[model samples]
Target: MPHSNSPMTEVLVAADCWRNEPDAEAVIQRAITAAAGNVDADVAGADLAIMLTDDAGIRTLNGNWRGIDKPTNVLSFPALQPTGARSDDDAPHMLGDIAIAYETMRREADDEGKPFDHHLSHLAVHGFLHLIGYDHESDADAGAMEALEQEILAQLGIPDPYGNREGMD
Candidate 1:
């Protein structure tokens, strides 16, 4: 495993969107807990800024950063040193950032019939994992990642996202 020169994981969460939901803080903390547990890492003194923004902001970000020109669910920019980059011995490493689109998240929750908190928690954990270099680009990779996600969510008291016997629709 690659570790930043720092001793903890940093989370920054910013919410610029309308939130009818009142438990964003708790949701974010739950995510942080799940992420930290999964990696067996601790969070050092850090700043986690979560933004609750609309599709416009997300779309702009997606276009500028990812070249996708679309509003996606979440995006993570990891500040972890590049694959072979050296760590600065003195400063705490900065774990980049995670951005989530609020509307999309809510829509997904409604569509899936999963509680909003559960869906948000899942995304938060997922984003944090990405910050630590986890990805699901291939079928096998997705299976592994999803399994870990399921376990983490379960630990957080979320139902099995894939426990249904039929399979994903």
Candidate 2:
């Protein structure tokens, strides 16, 4: 049974490419649970969405939202909330939405010699952290965010994703 405070995760398959990994939804859910549980704030009972999209889908989003015009591994779109509680008490708090590109993730995993699930978990954790206001805009912030990602993935028995990068250790 899930804890009453556990955040709710909704996984949507926006592309057929995700069918290559039938366990994508479960992997994402596990990663999100681990991440939300370890975060400093109380994100319990919150609701978040994960879109398993393909390169073309992510490219459109990147072009529209980030103006990058290229497909990335994952993108996090956090919901904006006010300073006060919601007027509707019964509604769950909206955390944010995360979209992951299937082809990019697969290629990255293959290149890194990591299992597909492990890479998926890492991406999900990274996106969840972004939704919670953790960013890598500066060196200090990147270090902090990456450290937290390492810790969370470690809990899932995933080897350090950043270990291969020089000076990231």
lDDT (0 to 1) per candidate: 0.70, 0.90
lDDT of 1 by residue, 7-45 (tens): 244333345555566787567676676666567444443
After aligning candidate 1 to the native by TM-score, how far in Å is the CA of 12 from where it should be?
Answer: 6.6
Q: Write the per-residue lDDT of candidate 2 for residues 17-101, one digit (tens) a residue.
A: 8888889998898888888778887788788999999999999999999989999999999998768656666577889899999
Lowest summed lDDT over 10 consecutive residues: which window, candidate 1? Answer: 1-10
Candidate with the greatest lDDT versus the true structure:
2
| Candidate 1 local lDDT, residue 168 | 67
Candidate with maximal TM-score: 2
The TM-scores, one per candidate, come to 0.79, 0.94
Clashes of each: 16, 0
